[model samples]
Target: MSPGDGNDDDLYGGTGQTRTRLPDGGQGDMYGGAARRPARSSSRSLITVVGVVVLLVAAIAFANRGNSSSDDGDAKKPDTSPTAPTGTKAVTSGFAHDKQGAQSAAANYAVQLGSAEMFNKAQRDRILQEVITPSRVTGFEDTLDKAYSPEFNTNVGLNKDGSSPQGYTFVSRTTPIGTKATGYSASTANVAVWCSGLLGMAGENSKNPVTNSWFTISMKLEWTGGDWKIVTHSQKDGPAPVPGDERASSSDEIANAVEGYGGFTYAR
Candidate 1:
């Protein structure tokens, strides 16, 4: 199916978090704005990093692959990896002071940065406060305020004010598949998180049906205020896997699943 239409490049990208190099050797617009609107193709291509979703797909495939020995030879084993669920909201603190800590921070920050809440002004401000480096919070807030404008909201299937319509739910969630620390020092680090994402409006006859995307987010973090806080971040499209043959769910099913399932606080 179509991944919806229009200039919602910011909706998928850093959500005003990533920086890009412009044609004139200027910095990229974090999200789509008038300054960047005329360069739609180039800007969107630079910033439209896809988001993520649930991990049950592989598990379900393993369980239902059948018992035939012929198929068994090719059947993959189920992933039995242990998870590091925090049992807390994504707005967490007190991460360790090492490379692992940087990975953990990147994972959690990806969740908040890519959430539906980021589309709303108040919630967005609150998120910036929690995840952004103290010295950079004001700058992030200013850039994002203009990034998530009413026009941007409407383009992405939300109301002009960035709220879901009465009967629909706007979904924008990110799930980190894994994280890696690329650079590390005593007080600074760079990490990348491979993630899967889900976005769109879920409801009957919804033009923007919830869809999946794959992307990687790269973040530069610093040990600030006793915890890792984002200094800057950027995203790129993939290392995506091949699509499976499973039938897509109905809009109602997608909506129900989103409501029923709560998000996680990720760790390295």
Candidate 2:
């Protein structure tokens, strides 16, 4: 049941010792022609019955302990390896070279779009302008600005300035699983990013708890303004796996880690 609700006492009902007195009637007389058979069991029979019971109890205890240990151990293991890319490089690279550069670009862009800074209007605008087509950049910035308004920030427990409260850490980190270019042309590409993200806050007395989500983000990329710029992008939920054994990191640790690690600019 619901993790850590087991007890040894419940397993072996009361104490190991049980006193069952047989009735002094027909069954007793059938064995010894007396209204009551001797109150005492023969030493041999008593030992035999006790031995059988002890063996049964021991077997049950061993089985329960083994099962419990297995469950506990399984809960602590982490699943960190990335999953295989569903689409082949050949399928993705119709126009561009099916080499490291395209892969790297897709990966880097995915990370940038998935960063925590994307939730801030000013930061998001700068990122969008840097990573999107010049023609579509204004529209993207406007849409995102509207999405991350004061009410949305408040709902996510961020201050009016979009900063986390002191001692609290907001987490929004994405790990790319794989990149696929669905359609590629000489100057444009449609890239799909399969990713996993940790989103929410972690801290003592924090209202929000850290949570994981899996999603696929697809972007229509145009080679404009000296780089690949996203013209359009969309996201859909996961092909996620079962949870793993890593101990939950505290809010302060999560915050420190995020600040310490610098994000990448991908090209492949």
Candidate 3:
């Protein structure tokens, strides 16, 4: 269809074409020979443009109001420096002498508990004996032994000796976000460790793939055998964020990287 044909509907007004009589009074041509529209006065056009700009600005401001509220609400205000510890005075006072020491102990203990060594029976038993309460150490060892059985290792693509297969590299590493003492006494404290971890195998044709996990590990700690030891511990999933852009490393590279890296003894 030809644009603006008389047969076509006119979106703005009447017929697509208009006729105007000539001043001489003869038959007038359609559109008066491409009739020109009445020119808008400069003042009127300026007013129209100003009105449109005002409406656009108002609409943009309204749309941004909600965004401004969110920005203001989501931002945390800066905390004023504290004069001294204020809450739970009794619990704080009981462990006052050992606050720093306890935090350091819990952080280091968390790293060890989440290490790959926990998958090996001998190494695990030794760790438990060193880091767990005397009364609960045996029970914890037995439970962990049951948990890290041959079947479990096989499920994770690990050999019976708790080693990764020839071509597959098992990656299990925990990064601690922070640690807090929820309950503290002269002899006992409940420490919670927030952590993110990477676990699984990275290898061509590998059945298991590396995945990230966020979890909070809570440990019931006791001052036993002259040092802090874990009596019990539990884990729950996270406050996780969206994944980022990073290429996955190959199995051999992952294995070598883990071998080359050494774990740290954390302190707060």
Best by lDDT: 1
Model 3 spans > 4 angstroms off: 1-97
lDDT of 3 by residue, 81-189 (tens): 1111111110111122364556656655555555555666775666656666677666665545555668756755679777778766565555668888888888888
Residue 36 displacement (Å), model 2:
60
Q: If ranked by lDDT, best first, what sequence of candidates would result? A: 1, 3, 2
Q: State the displacement of the C-alpha of residue 243, model 3, in Å, after optimal TM-score superposition.
A: 1.9
Candidate 1: C-alpha RMSD after superposition: 14.0
Tell me the lDDT of model 3 at 241.
62
Tens-place lDDT digits, model 2, residues 77-126 = 22221111111111111213333334445555555555556655665665
lDDT (10s digit) by residue, model 1, range 18-137? 221223322332222222212212222322332211110000000111112233223232222111122322235677788887787788777767776666677667666777788877
Write down the lDDT that model 1 would get.
0.56
What is the Cα-based TM-score of model 2? 0.59
TM-score of each: 0.70, 0.59, 0.60
Better of 2 and 3 by TM-score: 3
What is the descending TM-score order? 1, 3, 2
Model 3: lDDT to the true structure: 0.44
lDDT of 2: 0.43
RMSD in Å for all candidates: 14.0, 27.0, 31.7
Per model, state how many residue pairs clash.
5, 14, 0
